[model samples]
Target: METTHSPIRPIPVHPGLPVIGNTLEYLRDPLAFFRRLQRDYGHERMVRINVGGRATTLMLKPEETKQVVQENNRNYGRGKSFAILKTFLGNGLLTSEGDLWRKQRRLAQPAFHRQKLAILAETMIEEAVAWADRLEKVADNKPVNFSTATTDVTLRIVTKTLFGSSLGDQLDSLSTALANLNHFAINAVVNPIRAPKWVPTPSKRNFERATTQVNNLIFGIIESRRKTGETRDDLLDMLLRATDEETGEGMSDEQLRDEMVTLFTAGHETTATSMAWTLYLLAQHPGILQRAKAEIRATLGERSQPSADDLRAMPYSSQVINESLRLYPPGWVMSRLSLGPDRFGDHAIAANEGVLLSPYVLHHDPASWPDPEHFDPERFAPELSKERHPYAYMPFGGGPRLCIGNQFALMEMQALLIVLLHRFELRPVPGLQVTAQPLISLRPRQAVQIYLS
Candidate 1:
């Protein structure tokens, strides 16, 4: 006898305006839109919604997310969602797909290994100490934008570690250019109807100019290194010296530039955002702040420089950073296009469909975390965390496409927090409100004002 199977059903669609669908609601407020989806249709595991004139399914469960990003990831690709990013990042690890991604990942893997990153910890601590010293000169109790401050310090750290040289006078220009490119990329992602590349709109002009500026800076570094025959043993030197085992071939200057810019942008932006949020949370919770400071002091008494071993010894500090990432993950939402048909429970998905996975949503799920809104670092304690689903708390993402620089970012944050907290006390400024702004990264909607004394 032959057996019959029930046909897969279409995922429920969220009601929205004709044609445009949920774009307005999404653009108006992305986080709220996600929460609304969770409230209204989360039981379905997947919900279809039109975003920017395309139908996409929002993955609502940890298991569903794991399947898309890990178990059956081959059926999904970066697709058109990353077109704007590819415009700037070229085919770097974040945006590349298939064999290219595999090859690049192989080549870049060695540069971010534990041993390689251990050597960079000294540079990270020095930069953090220098930042703390600069802050010491500022008037105590005066308000400072901690968000911008963190960005500046992280940028310096990444520049030194990546290029083996301080940015010096070029810092401001490079920062501005990268900011411009980031702004353009996010806007273009939401507004699908963008002017043609040659149209020369204000945004387009700014983007092109910024792209050129960044290109000049990166290519200049590569050219100078080649001409000087210098080996600083920094990330650049490692990439320069890396060769494919099969072909014994190395990355060309253009390839190096792509990977370098990808690392530079991703390296600084995500770490800075995480640090800013961590500092902000500590300011709001005085007890947590004090406890973290006590841990720092106990771990490194009278020692301003924190070594890799010192970082490992500060578990509470690590927990604080972990909790902050859970609350305000920099890479909040990720997108992929289906390359083949797939299924989630009884719901059917066709090839070419778009899928959205949000770490922010998963991290805050009440099912996985009781009293999810409450700030609690102890939730990440090894004893408690071992019981949770692996995909339930993916701050740096997961699977093969996980952020390559996750370890680097974590150590950078740990070093900065240890040095900065040891040197001064951080107090939130009165009457200042900070909210999450969903950009290329989840940034504070405004300057996170705080006082250092």
Candidate 2:
């Protein structure tokens, strides 16, 4: 009998110029590149990614991804994947590892807890109506970027829900600052980290200016709220009261800034992006849009507004949101650095390795989703009984660090969708293509326009 050795595994790699790795190409089109890797290499395989002189192995296996994200997860953190975000976010819960992140999460939990969320639901409905009214006023025979409208509504809603109704006074500056910061954040992903912060690079300069302005604004808000003797039921109140059970110490101002920045970014931008895509998707598929509108109308009635309770009554609307996330999740790619030498089904993954899990790729997997490109919401239907891997559909992620704002984002989107249906029937503008621009989140490349019918 001949001695048998284990078959050598092939780590997938695409060609790139020296030092740049696949940085330019990957930036040009992330979704396509990732899909190519999946096609050429079998599942549970490795992809040697060259991102500006860095060579990292990205594993795309759902099982391996589950192991990394959930079971064996540690303080592996956002790693270099989000190195640029640190300039804007600092040691926020989204980027911080270990005790710092844990403490921040605890401090911020109450603001998003059940009771406060109930209050927020009412606020969400009010904001939704306000958005619809604004659109109703602008129902001229003109083209509108439905994506922009959706993003604006969600942004204002999240700001209001997190800080209360007085938030609009600060939102204009916050919105501009966020827009500037998002570009810089993306540049930070591609540019060398060692470069001086004051360097003439437009992105770095823009980042510094935006962060300073945003911090001043955020810190001012925190200070004003702290000075108020009256305790209001919002995120600020919860942050003030949160104390570590073991240490009985509250988070300091610096810690608060980190958490606030994290929330400001995660709390709004992701929700805005998701809502934007959802509105565009509903516009693209009229049948689905009609069904969603019918559900929203039946549940909400021709009433003044739809409250939080009304939200629970719209299941198909929720299904549409779920399907949209499945097809175009806001959080497209997240990576975790390995702690030690590890083995995943005989692959000798090394210590300190960077492993990536992409919802964009997994969501579009043909083997997993039938007629994957079709705009079918049935994929997430409550009635469907088909078996799919748990990791195959990770919109908010899994494991210990699963997105705490999962409930908040979903509720916010549901409210926005309901109001959108009442205001107008969106019809797609021709010759415009909307594709996922992969970043910290999978933001849409261009504003998707629609007729405000």
Candidate 3:
């Protein structure tokens, strides 16, 4: 006997204004718009909404989302959405596609291997301990903007780990240039009407100047390393020594710069933002905070620094970090462009269309998470987590292109939390409202003010 299959249907389109479509609604407030879609048509699996004069499909179901990002990822390339990022990153692992991406991924893989990351964890703890000591000296029961504090510490850690050198006098200017460049890139992504690149708009000029500043700094490091032939067992050293298995060739200076900058850009702020959110959430929930503290005390005893083995023993602390990431994933929304036709259950998607998969939306789905808005780390307890879909809680993303530094980020967060929580008690500032700002990463709109006593 032959079996019959259901007919494929066109994806449902959300009603929108002519030409501009849903762009206005999206621009006004992106997360709200996404939540509204989930509330209204979430069962539809896929819904099409026009943004900036183009139709983009939103993948609403976890199963379909998994297929697009993991199983059929080849058909969904980085596409035009990453063009602005490419202007700065220049075909780095984050933005590259096809053979170049494959080659880059291969060359960079060994640096993140388990043994290598074990060595890097020491630097993470050292930096976190240094940061905690500095805070103790100046905190004096006054509110500190932990967002800024975490950013500074994480930048230091990444600088030491990646280049094996301190920024020294160049730190402030380099930080400012990256900040300006980030602001420019994000604005360009959202605004539909952009002046030609040749036009010297103030924003464009700033972006160009920032790009030059960053390029010069990175190239200077590369030149110095080549001339000196020094070895520090840092990421740059590994990259310099890494040879392609296929051709026995190493990355050129330009390639090294791109990867280093990419790592710097993607690595630092995302970890810092997540740490700030974790701190904010802990401040708000004293009981949960105490539980994490108890676990840390039991695991590490009187040790000021947590080794890799000690970090692995703190299960509750890891759960708190996972729960915080679910609430405020730094890489909130991920985009892919279709290289060919595809189907999600009964719905069909055409070639060249843009598809969005939001970890933020998936994480907050009521089907997978009961009382989705509640902050409950117990939801991640092993027994409960085993029953949930794997894709339901992907804070670092999923599949072949999953963030390379995910383990590095988690270990860093765990180490910092252990050191800081051991030394001080965190309290929230009264009458302050913290909101999430969606940028290159999800960050707090204002400083997350907390007092240490």
Task: Please provide, for model 2 over 152-225, each residue's C-alpha lDDT reduced to its tens digit, 9 standing for 90 to 100.
Answer: 77777767765765575678888788779877777666555556655687666777788888889888878887
Q: Model 3 reaches what TM-score against the true structure?
A: 0.97
- Model 1 misplacement above 4 A: 1-6
Alpha carbon lDDT of each predicted model: 0.89, 0.77, 0.89
Give the clashing pairs for model 3: none
Model 2: ten consecutive residues of lowest lDDT = 3-12
lDDT of 1 by residue, 344-399 (tens): 76787889888999998898888888888788999999989999999999998899
Per-residue lDDT for 136-235 in model 3, tens only? Answer: 9889968999989999999998988998878797777777888888888788887778998889999988888999999999899899999999998799
Which residues of candidate 2, in runs, are more than 4 Å off? 1-21, 191-194, 197-202, 383-386
Over 4 Å off, model 3: 1-5
Which of candidates 1 and 3 is the stronger one according to TM-score? 3
Better of 1 and 2 by lDDT: 1
RMSD of each: 1.8, 3.2, 1.5
